[model samples]
Target: MSNKTILITGCSSGIGRVTAKYFQTKGWNVVATVRSNPEAQTELNTLENVLVTGLDVTNENSVSTAISEAIERFGRIDVLLNNAGYGSYGVLEATPEQVIRKQFDVNVIGTLLVTRNVLPYMRRQKSGLIINISSMGGKISFPLGSLYHGSKFAVEGMSEALSFELETIGAGVKIIEPGMINTNFAETVGAAFNVDPTQTEYVAFVSKVMEGLETANSNHSEPILVAETIYEAATDGKRQLRYIAGADAEKIIAARKQLNDDDYMMLIKQNMGL
Candidate 1:
């Protein structure tokens, strides 16, 4: 049983919840933060070594308070997991400005704020790990995924740059790029931003695409796979800057490495039947 203390964000359902439970089972002290999900609160509270807290990642005060509370409870934070993010699925032009702002606010800026707040303690300890949960979309783009892709790309860039900056300081930064994990994330996107047939000419096209995604997501890698990947990243002595979680995720990364811009888009278009 590892005695390392870790803080994780977005622990209501899906990957975050799974990771929290997995870490607790491994004997790690975990501070799991969720944004007011009563059921999730009840479920997480059942864990022995886990501390469940209310956290709205996009809110500055909430972010600060969560970090502070974790520090107070755990004494020190050995790992910080920025896993709170959601997707906005739609064409870039079709996506509202407010929606775009909110997407970036939660997925990109929230990550920045959380990392910024937690870094001081890690820096003082001179030994800590910061893990950002990105998507395979970070490396590859899909149609109707512009807004979602943008946020993940930002995470990828930030993680890469931060990894270089932190390497010399004995701290480590890593990113987990999971591919289409079986989770409620896709359902959330479908519920939050369904394509309006009357609003755009590509409505039918988008609907078909979304249907395909819904099917794919239903049978994708389980949340436990991502949880285990995160656990390995956090505890492994030889650290890597990025760990691709699923087989599909690894394939996406490999494709990104092998294909160029036009070819990649062509492949996506073909696969998605766009």
Candidate 2:
């Protein structure tokens, strides 16, 4: 237990940062990665039993180097937490094709590449876990966030299929569907929007939705809650596939399940005053 290691991506902040620290607290070796320079990972750098490194998931060299470095340091990795992802905001029509490509590159392709790299080791060792950090957004869509939802939906689908395949090798794969958490996600998503300034037709609709999202953010749950759920998913020996991280996540997922697609979409539009 004390020597167990978990390699997590996107450890710069939010759920990734918290989960890395949380696992370290339980006496496990933690390999945490940030896209920025390793010297900038102040908090993680100071922690004992934690290895802070640079990893840009969308970059092939960075991803391979991170995994190699983690294994070289710890000897083995017991869990791989795919916590690196961001929301791509704006209407689909307004979003550039390059933005869509980058969005999927990080959220979907990065996840695939990392998992592929880790599986060989896990398969040889006959044990491992992969916890993908998804969102309620993955299951439920919203106005003007088509790209974000698309990436998450891709994550969910891939994780689902990989779970069955990995289980054969004594490994596990699970999804963490977190609701809006208190994080820099809002600011990041705001700055990440690829909307064209001249696209005034979607302006009003996007603004209303953004306002509602801001209100939601103000009331969002703590990131530590999602981290705790990540822990649950890792340690829970049962072959469960998905663990909803917050009360709101559970509520929204349940609501979506109870309503038809058209009804859910209509309700969402009404909430944004469309």
Each prediction's whole-model lDDT (CA):
0.87, 0.89
Model 1, global lDDT: 0.87
TM-score of 2: 0.96
Clashes of each: 0, 0
120-171 in candidate 2: lDDT tens per residue? 8999999999989889988998877778999999999999988888879999
User: Over 4 Å off in model 1, which ranges?
Assistant: 37-40
Top TM-score prediction, candidate number: 2
Model 1 shows how many backbone clashes?
Answer: 0
Please give each candidate's TM-score.
0.94, 0.96
After superposition, candidate 2 runs with Cα above 4 Å error: none
User: Residues 1-274, candidate 1, lDDT per residue (tens digit)?
Assistant: 7888999999888999899999999999999999876345887898787888888888889988988998998889999999999899876656678898999999999999999988889888988999999989899877788889999999999999998888776798999999988888877897778455567788778877877676667658999999999999998877678899998888878988999998988887777777
